[model samples]
Target chain A: MEREVNAYKCRKCGTLHYPFRMVCKNCRANDYFEFDIEPLPKRGKLLTFTFIHNLPAQFEVARLGLGIVELENGIRVTGQVDIEDPTLGMDVVGNVEVVRHDTYDDRYGFVFRAA
Target chain B: MRDVYIIGIGITTFTRLEYPLSEIAAYASMGALKDAGVTDVDYVLVANMGSARINNQSALASAVVDTLSLTPAGAVRIENGPASGASAIKEGFMAVASGMHDTVLVVGAERMREVNNLEATDFVATLTHPMAEYIYGVTLPGHAAMFTRLYMEKYGVTERHLAMVGVKNQNNAMLNKDAHLHQKITMDGILDSPEAFTNNPWVAEPIRFFDCCPVSDGGAALILASKEVAEASGKPMIRITGIGQATDTLAVHERPEPTDLMAVRIAAQRAYEMAGITAADIDVAELHDAFTILEIAESEEVGFFEKGTGHLALERGETAIDGKMPINPSGGLKGKGHPVGATGVAQVHEIVVQLRGDAGERQVKDARTGLACNFGGFGNNVVVSTYARED
Candidate 1:
């Protein structure tokens, strides 16, 4: 077992949302900011990915792999891809780890690998 | 609503400039004012994205107004990421259309070249979701490249099709004197030949250097006037017939169908409805091709072609300057240069040039009606417009 990234579920509609928002998208007929914290399932399938050779100034790498992954719980999230040869629809498991190293500190995000 | 007409237009060369951001905007504003034969405007709207962050300049509209000696005029800068140009014009359109102002000057300018390549890339990357995408170091190219992978598989599109778009837009740019990157690139050199790897290296896999628009520094201006003021200006009556805008999920991965540009579709439909016309009625167009694939993808999204069939239209030579319904004759953002703030206004500038039959060698034949698509962010925020020659 490892540390988990959280997804907020609407208390009213039971809809799941990541990178939480002010209002619930599915059903807003309930109290504001009423959401349940749920641990996101890490096992998923790779959707689409790219190996970016042109990177931002912050990333200290010749190239970086990034992708959108569909989690086992049906939540899709963008994460760093560490897989050597990631094909679309391939099984992947995510781990919460440091994805960026800023001047101040390291930023934690999902990093995916072949399951 | 009162009729709003484009009485005058102006633009600076789409290339690196050694001028200040305010000066660049003022320079274009002066050109537009002189074109309209007016010394003063009722209101001023400046469209800029990175003036403060990249150029270390803030209150851009105030700076430009004072620099042009247009003091005491109410002004503000409209920033909508890459769609700032069209968004400013949209505001200017409202000002005049609502009878609040008789004449409004809208200018879109940016000096992204003021910073180093790394900083500029990060600046543009700010459009993505910070917690979800940016923390993953997800740049715009990376986002587009991932979307392109889905497109290639779902629609049977290939690298050759992507290269064709790059070839057409870049070559079309040579005809535009104001466009950046005047160098001629061929398919053999960029895609087919052994030296292709050296010539068009990957910026993001599936997207080569040629596929992405160059980081440009430039400005474009437009003068929107009420019918009475426009009649006095004596320019070809180019009426603003339609304006439509829509937004989707800010994060690209959040959308149910990742490759589907729902905002583009919805925005264009609204625009067409406002103009009382359909896609087939458009004689010419300027689509936001920040990346080559966008031109193809947006064509379908905007109803010019069926979904996933835009590439087929490209293969049929239907999107060329001489082909049926020519798109991006001014080289689009791909060739013309994409100064984030200026791109939307520059798109309209080209369309107006076409509708007025003043586009010279790049003009679409009998272009009585034209459309411009100003895309913001990664298909999240979009503004689509329709323009017509009204005698």
Candidate 2:
């Protein structure tokens, strides 16, 4: 089975990184490890946003919405958003849903939703 | 100090082709040699900015040398992000000027169309901090959009301002046979383009699809020779009066003002100091317009206009071919097509054409002095070169 996606906390700096990193940027240490993968908070506010009209075939269904959101932990992360209005400093949050399922390929990604 | 002169230049039409990267370099090199009237080249400097991302291959210089069958010639590849072409030119200029070689060839090429759009974007994101910016999915357009917002909010330059830049460059590109997107642009087309307007959509808040340069595959080359060799060859020479390079922090947040590209200013000042001339003395110029806002921002940074006035100057027709100071007569990166590494060398080629009064229809009238600027990775690295037509 494919591994579930989750945030990995830096052992040295307590910073959380999506995807993954070999080293913590803040502490400059090679101690990127997580004991238990916890679901990230799905509700937050939008820091800034852009409406991407032209996108690759995968993202063409709906215009791509790129946004930076402040997580409940005060961590700012950039991700895809499905919100209508992209006003600055708007409330946004992450949703634990498959953004797009490549049926033939079978891959999924996390996307953001306005709370 | 020994003097260096660029005697010849050549560029292939920017297009999507099935040719290998090395093959493209060979074609451009041969054209440059023909332009220089040289049978033997002492050294070759290769510039390719995105081969690794496009093909998962690196070390393009050796491939070029083997393809060209230039045995025992010194060969090196240079990378300065998008400014790879100008960076290679600087290396070749220094090599000849320092008496390391009598004649040197600088060629810049890239094949981005070979990859899919997502792959290309991913490749460019490698230029940023992998852990910080790339993981955040910060695309190049995002950076330009951020700059556009800052310029608009701070200087009152609007989307209309950027569109005007597109309109002028597209019109000029129509005159350039070598340009990639040669179709003329109207202000309405820029403002109301299907891909940029309400029906079309926006990419980043301020920048739209039309505001960006094309992902093109092309090659451009220039031959540099010592003053003695250039004069003895009996070929027309475009003197390289000065070349200066400077770098700033890579991250956008690190800068004091994201809208102002200070590296361009410092580099241009150094070039002017060496060439003993100011921006006003330049009759023609080719600036890296990877995005519309880049042209305006770099122009202001290079002291071509007062801050926030670059858009006004473009609207006033001061930057057209017939204007007092013509910029990007080659259609700029927007219209001429930007192949990353090829852009800087192409800029120099356009300057040579302008200085020799050989640009044909788009020639800047009485262009005696010309300047070219190329910036890499959102103004992090910059190269400024000055050229003069010797009487």
Candidate 3:
């Protein structure tokens, strides 16, 4: 099965949200678990990107490329950009991947690459 | 609401101090109390960020109050990310303005140097959205770098502009006796020299070493009182005429426009409205320039310049100590050092000193009105305060 990033859709308003929230931002009327899980678009345009040499201790690499991408549906998400050379508004594609590891478990998020 | 005035102010050197966190806080408070010629306050608010995590201390307010022997006064610890200091002051203002407390001692202190560099960065990053930004290994500098890229693209702000702010503030720190980075920095040495690359390497792309603030341990204290108490003290009436605070979305990606800091804009607007003054009325300002780019961005957001034109003003030497609009004359967070919790209060401390004409070398001439903007948590929360000195 192919892995994909998930976004939450408000059942009442059809408003999509990333990382899931208890209430719909648009409608503001949501009960517990009153949202549907929807897969986020893998294709997007890199809005802004940064190569950071300073990372948390968990990230052992010398430098990490990160960016905010505007998806095809107009939703923006922060993700790790694997593209060696990233330009603003450049087309990109992403997949659900392990971004970091805590003391015991791995965390999964979108990792983008040049399209 | 009744008016609130700053009767006394004190601060320890914004550098690493080999003292306990509570002592750091108490030391500053003592100076404030001495300056006010009062040994007691009706309340105490301690602002700190990393005492529990880095310094292995907790219930910080209790310790500080006890150390200062201001016991039995209502005490609370305020943790509002980097804006903790000003947030604490805001509460103090409310207490006094509402006639609940006659006098409130607000102290902003931090001991971030107790931990190593990576550890300090990690702790600060904890303020970011957990599942979204933090798990992805996002740090503040990382966020600033990404934001800087966008601002540069949209507003034409360059690396040179960022370096100019760095050089200006760091050199300004040389005049600030209590500032952290007292060493003088020049554009030539940091940017134009042959070995400038190594001298100012990129910590985050587009954010070089000089672009960021040093992690220091220090404290700043302010005593807020009513008009009666302030007038009785016989000091320059540095009244906090305007106070405004606003919060943005916790996740930066959630904002409608990534480049716009709606919180800062809204907060400053509210402050200007409350004070019944425009940006032009402000004679001096101390902005939260944790990063160099922030100085320029906030200058625009706080209505100092037209949007996208702050850097142009900087190039015209408009933000210098004697310029039309002086900014970060105390070196700001960039050079004075960012003791997290202490920064917001320290910014106000500089404004108070400036308004009173106590800042000898870096005083803005004939400064009567001043402003301080304390930003928190990647622009998610911010506080803007305006003050006036009535002689």
What DockQ, between 0 and 1, does each candidate earn?
0.89, 0.16, 0.87
The per-prediction i-RMS, to one decimal, reads: 0.8, 4.5, 0.8
Q: Model 3: clashing residue pairs?
A: none
Per-residue lDDT of candidate 2, residues B51-96 (tens digit): 7667667889888888888867989989889888989998998898
Candidate 3, residues B242-262, lDDT tens digits: the string is 999999999998899988999
User: Per lDDT, what order, best first?
Assistant: 3, 1, 2
Tell me how candidate 1 scores on lDDT: 0.91
> Model 3 off-target regions past 4 Å?
none
RMSD list, candidates in order: 1.0, 5.1, 0.9
lDDT tens per residue, model 1, A1-115 = 6777889998888899987776788987457669888989989999999999977777889999999999998899999999888899999999999899988998988999999
Docking class of 1: high
Top DockQ hit: 1
Between candidates 1 and 2, the one scoring higher on DockQ is 1
Best by lDDT: 3
Judged by whole-model lDDT over C-alpha atoms, candidate 2 comes out at 0.79
